[model samples]
Target: MLPRPPRTVQVLALWAACTATSLLILRLGAADTGATPWAGPAPSWGEHLRFWDAGWYERIARQGYPAVLPVDGAGVVQQNAWAFMPLLPLLTGLLTWSGAGFYPLAAVVCLAASAGAAVVLDRWLAPRAGGAASLWAVALVWSSPCAAVLQVPYGESLGLLLVCAGLWLAGRRRFLAALPLVALAALARPVGVPLTGALGLWWLMEEAQARGTVPRAALARLLPGHEVLEARQRRGLLVLVLGAATATAAWPVAAWLVTGRVDAYTATETAWRQGAAPDVLPWLARSATWVGPHLGWLLVLGVLAAGALVLSAPGVRSLGAVPWCWCVSYCLYLLVFFDPTSSVFRLLLPLAPAAWAVGRAGTRVRALLLVAGVVGQLFWVSWVWDRTVQMTWIP
Candidate 1:
């Protein structure tokens, strides 16, 4: 027998286990929402065969976009609602026309696509980090907030797949090929803008590291207690610019098409909800609020403390470039944009690269944090599903 687990075997094991666990959690939660007879009602599946977002998407899928619908006291068109991103409904339509009758079928397609994205992410990060760490990285992503979006007729799964593929390709020094995939991802979710920027940052770092400018002394100063590889950073400015250009190309008419003004999209979003600009104090307070509700306090504290420690740890400062950039970008998007429930962050699910790097200093701690995140997410999802069924609201 091999002395150690082959990376492939480990990855397959991780995938199988995560898939089974997610399904089981979802199945138990779906028991109350009424499942389709074909998918069985005992163990059950999915909360409400026709859920709120699922209904909106299904309507779009089956009948195409209905521009206007009468709201409580006014006629509101979906285009103004922002729930009408085209990609998910488009895919669901294709599947339905091909005889997949939605619900379990759509969920199945979403899970399969998400699994594929996770595997692709594993493949991309394994060489940089190691098999075990890479598996954990992908698992963390698969278990993030609103992950159930993947189990509905949502574009999150496909959008994530495209984003992961783009990140993987970008990592391999294939920026040109990454552009279109990134564009597709952008079309699926606006958060692709920041993720694309992160990928470009990684490419740039790779180029910088390749140039041999990293001083061994400076690296040692950073990671005082650890040994590290000496390297130069890569040239990533061109890649970053290219990715930005491509993303812009995809949303070119956001102004003229959506609101008829150059930046009506922004006004529309702000008019919908109040969001602060990315000022430091406000961001910190807002982040705390968001994290408090979305993440357990212990988990939040631990992640923050861990992040600080890692930045100070040996060989980790440079390692932080990716995640720091991601955190910054995510913050900007979250603050400057609308729809906290939007598909953008879902597309950037490949943050595993940076997550892995951050995990380097304390693997066990990071793993525990990931487990906590998954458990919290499972509970949150189940609770929300239950609440949705009980309440009269359609969100």
Candidate 2:
């Protein structure tokens, strides 16, 4: 057999392939539906990148967010510009200010961020899994059902880049260096808050082990007892915690300053649910309406069981304390807070680390799973992207 290319080469090739395939799929869907890729009256390649949340980002870029929240005649908060985060729009605004068109610049920003994320994932996994396995992990992440989000102007690409890069830095014991990335990640999406929480939990677990007080058997075995953290570790942990807290508060605090309401961010987010309660019963009832009662409950239970099994996999459990903690904590956070709508798949993009567990399988199994993921991506793009532009679904 011939020698393999460097891991970087392989990863880049994979990222390019996946990105091109996604764009092709988007183009085909647009043609079939007689819709253009660009947002307005004319068709253009940039159209494919401007859908759903892309419009919000473009608006923020062209015209800054509202100084005050907008409310309808009924006193309900209408979808105001503040509902979205600032980082992506700020970047797009800078590009637009430089005389670049909004949609094209936004697409470039998203595509670059997406590629950077894949590279970071490869580097993070290469040490734990060999080159081949790490490559598989990257492939799986890019081929996820909602992977199309990476190609759009949405914040998921930038958010994933920060999360993965921060975690990778943390894995190398560069806690201080990871702090700023985590801070930025927190601003990218609400997932950053949980990401910081996970890092803190990891630090606590490390501290506990250092103090010879193991909280659980799994943790005890994962991190054998050692003397209390060196002065450096302790200092690093303090800085990380402070940075994370500040980052998490950045959005909420901004909202409060703008709207003079403590619940400004929460209220804007809740508006998307249209006043619907977040209870599981309501979700199940809604699902029942779409698919009969018997199948609906069964589907819910099946998803829960599958999630539990995946989380419990030995590979996932065996991850280094920080990654494991981050994964489990993030998953639990989503379960309680995120509504189980179709968007859940997109929301789950932060769980990219879980792909490592799948990559641990034998070559044949890994290949089959990768193929399945690619197929899922095609179908997901067709279903979500096609319908979302038609106003049939919310991406």
Candidate 3:
């Protein structure tokens, strides 16, 4: 019998097909505002997808962060390039520094990085979820609902790549190696903040177990903590956790250092909230306003319940301690800090571990999800890329 193709080859082929399809769908149509799809005068098809947050990245890539923060009439800092992470744009800027355009070259970079993310995720999940299950997980993730951003000039692709690399390394008790990748991932996106908790939880498990000296009962199942790990491993794990903390702080510190303002990053972030506090209340209000005041709390409770169910599923739980912690932490971060928005879907990309469960979920279920996800991609690509939807959605 002939040998099968390697998993990485399969992953790349799937990625290429999806990327080509997404670009084709985008090129064939821009966005229709009820009348017809609006194809703006952007030089290429990818340019149509590069707007909103892409515009901010393009600005950052074209000209670095402004030394002076832009402010409104009321002395409030308005949204600016500081609100977005620099790594994606800075990397993209490398190509554009030679006079190439921003979005097209960025599209290439994002495609390559996201491919790396798929391969990492494939290897990362294989041990925990068998080879077949891991392949299914990768397929589901690359073709997920908001897969559009995977190809666009967004941070999600590169950030996810780094985040998964960090998770893969950290899971194997390779703390020292994971730290710099985690830091670079942090530099790419806000997702690094949640990764800190993932690493911290792993450290706590190992550190607490190591201190016990007496063997821990296996039931509680504190992962990365086994009978074999020594004092040195525990110490290295602690370093990983602290390094995650420092990585999360790098952006804010850099923003402050550059702009010479203590509140540069926070002020810029809050500009979007228009002074709303970071809490569940804003999310509740948004939900209530969207649905109704009476059902608002129910809606919030329902989402929490749904997340609990999803995370607790056998497949997700099988992802083991570090990845599961990341899923929970990222969810908590979104719930606490974010108000509901269309962009929330894209923010859920890091939750790909759940797809492991979804993948193992019966063949029929996987097929259904794939179909729904494709439909979602078509809708999201056409809907979000359309300029008119920009007023209501942030994808």
Whole-model lDDT values for every prediction: 0.55, 0.76, 0.78
Per-residue lDDT tens digits for candidate 3, residues 288-361, read 98789999888889999998887776667666777777888888889888878878888899888778767777
User: Where is model 1 more than 4 Å wrong at Cα?
Assistant: 2-9, 32-52, 63-84, 143-147, 199-240, 252-255, 258-264, 271-324, 335-350, 358-367, 388-395
As for candidate 3, its clashing pairs are: 31-37, 32-36, 32-37
Residue 243, model 1: lDDT of 62
Model 1 scores a C-alpha lDDT of 0.55
- Residue-by-residue lDDT tens digits, candidate 2, 100-143: 77878877888888999999987886666567777788888887
User: How far off is residue 298 in model 3, in Å?
Assistant: 0.6
Superior candidate under lDDT, 2 versus 3: 3
* Per-residue accuracy of model 1 over 1-395 as CA lDDT, tens digit each: 75877766666577667666665666667655444322434433433545545665666556753233223334322234343456666655566656657666667767777777777767765665666667777666656555555666666677767766866675455667766777777766555667756665545544544555766455445433223323321334365547665675455355446444554344334433343323334334444565664554555456457656644444333433444445445544444443333233443453444666644547687778777767865655555543424433212
What ranges in model 2 sit over 4 Å off? 1-5, 35-43, 215-217, 220-231, 276-301, 388-391
Could you tell me every candidate's TM-score relative to the true structure? 0.68, 0.89, 0.92
After superposing candidate 3 on the true structure, give the runs of residues whose Cα lies further than 4 Å from its correct spot.
Answer: 31-43, 97-99, 211-215, 218-229, 387-391
Task: Determine which window of 10 residues in candidate 2 has minimal summed lDDT.
Answer: 220-229
Best by TM-score: 3
State the TM-score for model 1: 0.68
Which has the higher TM-score value, candidate number 1 or candidate number 3?
3
Using lDDT, rank the candidates from best to worst: 3, 2, 1
Q: Pick by lDDT: which candidate is best?
A: 3
Residue 373 CA displacement from its true place in model 1, Å: 3.6
